[model samples]
Target: MMQRFIPLGNGYSDIYELMYIGRAMPERVRHMLVLHPFDENNPEASLALVMKPTNPGNFQPIYICLEGVPIPSKRYDLWRELADELQHDVIELTVSPSGKFSDQEIFFQHLIGILRTNHYLPRLQRSF
Candidate 1:
């Protein structure tokens, strides 16, 4: 299987797009993730939707709003709203701040490692 992070714009107005995708492909939705990172101060959270592999294809796409929304835990309404809309359990992972990485590619690699370590994603394989 191939996994990839497909970055969405920050979760401002772009949240609507995320919601639309979920609603449109509810069956494909596998897991919902909220990655939180903090430095001296709390930064925006990254919201992601993990979709199951497509038929005739083994691509598991993780769609994300990369860092720029209020932490849902602090905002009960938004959290509840997301939970309700997703209609599935959501997993929260606290992670090192994105700033710790020198670049976006590095940040994604770090996230992929975290996901694999936590058993949220499959271990890398030479062949599927």
Candidate 2:
């Protein structure tokens, strides 16, 4: 299965879209994540939803709103509500902030490693 992070903008509109996707495709939702970056002073967090891989294509998409939403806010509450509706517990993880990486892709790679290590995601299958 090929998994990729599909970034949604860091804003109110983006979060609404994320919630919409979760509500629209509740069955596809595999996991809900709250990525807390290493910077404790930072008030923002990244929200994500892992979707099951598509049939035939085997493409698994992890939708994310990157480090834009504030913690303990109405937006976060909305996310938690969505998770409850989907019957999933929000998975919280500590990670290096995106700012620590030179590029977004690198940051995503790092996140992938963490998810796999924590057993939230399956190990990558390499075609030799």
Alpha carbon lDDT of each predicted model: 0.79, 0.92
Lowest lDDT 10-mer window, candidate 2?
A: 36-45
Model 2: lDDT of residue 18:
93
**Residue 108 of model 2, lDDT score:** 95
- Model 1 global lDDT (CA atoms, 0 to 1): 0.79
Clashing pairs in 2: none
lDDT of 2 by residue, 1-128 (tens): 89999999884679999999999999999999999888977769999999999998989899999998888899999999989989999999889999999999999999999999998989999888
| Model 1, runs deviating above 4 Å | 72-76
Question: Evaluated with lDDT, which candidate comes out highest?
Answer: 2
Off by over 4 Å in 2: none
